[model samples]
Target chain A: MMSLRLQLGIIFIMLVVAGSIVHFLRRKSIDFRYALAWLFVDVVIIILAIFPRAMVWLSQILGVASPVNMVLFVGLCLSLVVIFSLSMSVSRLADKVRKLSQEIAIIRKDVFDGDNRVREEMNNIKD
Target chain B: MKKLVIIPAFNEEGNLEKTILDIKENAPAFDYVIINDCSTDGTLAMCRRHGFSYLNLPVNLGIGGAVQTGYRYAYYHGYDIAVQFDGDGQHSASYLPEMAERLEETGSDMVIGSRFITKEGFQSSSLRRLGIRYFTFLIRLLTGKKITDPTSGMRMINRKLMEKFTEEYPKDYPEPESVVTVLSEKHRVTEMPVIMNEREEGSSSISLGNGVYYMVKVSFAMVIARMKR
Candidate 1:
């Protein structure tokens, strides 16, 4: 049978692995421009997963006590989830902004060209 | 008054001759500059045949770029008034004097040929009509001015406005957005009642997907315009 300490570590590792997997899958549809942000988020998760003690220290500084271990573990897990969610939101927003800019650039180019192709395409879209 | 008409022509081979000839016959006093947007058709040939002043762009630039080029020419050459003429034949030259007179009387920097100023026939697609309505709402909200036809290319601007418009003109379907531009610059923009004829030849380039794209793009631009000091 695994010791309590090893069991806790295994659970932590599993949780981190599952989260990373889900995050990777979820973010796969995002644009390549957001790769750096997602990568940084993944790196933070990896660091937090490897050093559970760091989380304990953080909890202590935040005034978490009485069932210190439990509180720290839950706190760390919640913090990681929030961070991941925020990173995903930011990545998505970045993609939206980039798409907007590119569309503007193409339209801007078309205006000067006088090809009327863009206008025709827009008319067709309206129909 | 020495007036120069700036006509932005893009793939307008079909209507170029007639439009130019009409302008020549009606407003012969007004010298014209047709900005050829690297037309693949016989648009340039028509300009040459009519002996109209023209500038051929190396590559096709949309209405915004072509119009801005005209403005730049107007600013540099010292044109008293610059009128934006559409090569698509939607605008009539007969209304030029009336539109110009309105601008002169009001001391307005820009004068727009508004179809809604009177009962004018608008032949645009229904979706475009809705888009124009939305744009009209947006402009009124932003500029505190009730602009009926925000996308009319038949407009006139004086030397002062020509200088400013030449400096920075909106690219990509600029007509609707230009009201915001002129308003933000604290320039007076007035609209005149004028009827527009339907585009006679060549299909418009705007598509549904492109329309959605245009909406988002212009919305973002409006936000930026609002944020400007």
Candidate 2:
């Protein structure tokens, strides 16, 4: 069983995490889709912290040696999922950056060249 | 109908000017856009000095990205046809009209300027020729369409395929893999014989060390593209 002091410490950490997530959402620093994953992780942590016995029961059902080991395993798995999802998003962003850079180059040429052509035509008319 | 020629260049500082001038003199009707793929040379300076219609890519987006940029530009500009012309001065602008004519006559989605159709012009090195033949056989095996010059950089695509290419295109050694993409879509791809000149300047991008890797990688990309469709 987790001590009351340890439970209070976990609650404090959860509050800090939830607050940070809220701050990030309010500031629109992170997209909602990504924040949703982090928020889900915080909720799971809070639930596990609130009912330590639930984790102990889960460990017993899963044949884990201890509740602590179960918690570590779950944390590691969730972290892997989050990291994997982040890597996928990074890959997509890289592709978008490539396309955007290419489009910008093309548009820059169109606009600047148009301006140059008009200036040349004006000079030609003056001449 | 508006036709645009996309010349993708990488470190072709010496040859680029001549290539553009040749196009301007020979094929005055067709509009051309030079996609300067962040060359580590004076290519950009040359473009600016000549007031050439060129797109200076901020990053080095290989040949595939460079050509796709041209296609995207063509698509947005409402061009009816877009041709992928090389910046190295090997591709003659004189052949543009004939290729365009063939594209219209056959109503093909894409027309590739082939060096082997007439068995004339500067055929690539013997090893490169062997590799080309191997890919030709591989493409024929998968798509049942024979592409004699799968590695040729000179190609013309109609608006339909141009729109598709704008959405997604192969990245590395994209020529052969792109052929597979078009064939998988059941679009018509044909070849027109055109004479190619020796490179006016600059070294070829595919060196001997990477030749084998290029062949294997492109073959794998083609196979995977076929499977995905």
TM-scores, one per candidate: 0.64, 0.80
- Tens-digit lDDT string for candidate 1 (A43-84): 555454456566567656776553335444664666676578
Q: Find the 10 residues in a row with the least total lDDT in model 1 chain B.
A: B52-61
Docking quality category of candidate 2 according to DockQ thresholds: medium
What TM-scores result for chain A when each predicted structure is judged separately against the true chain A?
0.37, 0.84
Model 2: per-residue Cα lDDT over B15-114, one tens digit each? 9889988899888889999999989899899988888888889988888889999999999999999999999989999999888989999999999999
In candidate 2, the residue pairs with backbone N, CA or C atoms under 3 Å apart (3 or more residues apart, or in different chains) clash, namely none
What is the per-residue lDDT of model 1 for residues B39-140, given as tens digits with 9 covering 90 to 100? 888888977787656777665556777788777767766789999998888888888877778888999999988887675586477778888889889988
> How displaced is residue A89 in candidate 2, in Å?
2.8
DockQ of 1: 0.03
Model 1: how far is B119 from its true place, Å? 2.6
What lDDT is reached at residue A78 by model 2? 78
> How well does candidate 1 score on lDDT at residue B201?
89
Per-candidate local distance difference test = 0.74, 0.90
Model 1 alpha-carbon drift over 4 Å, by segment: A1-127
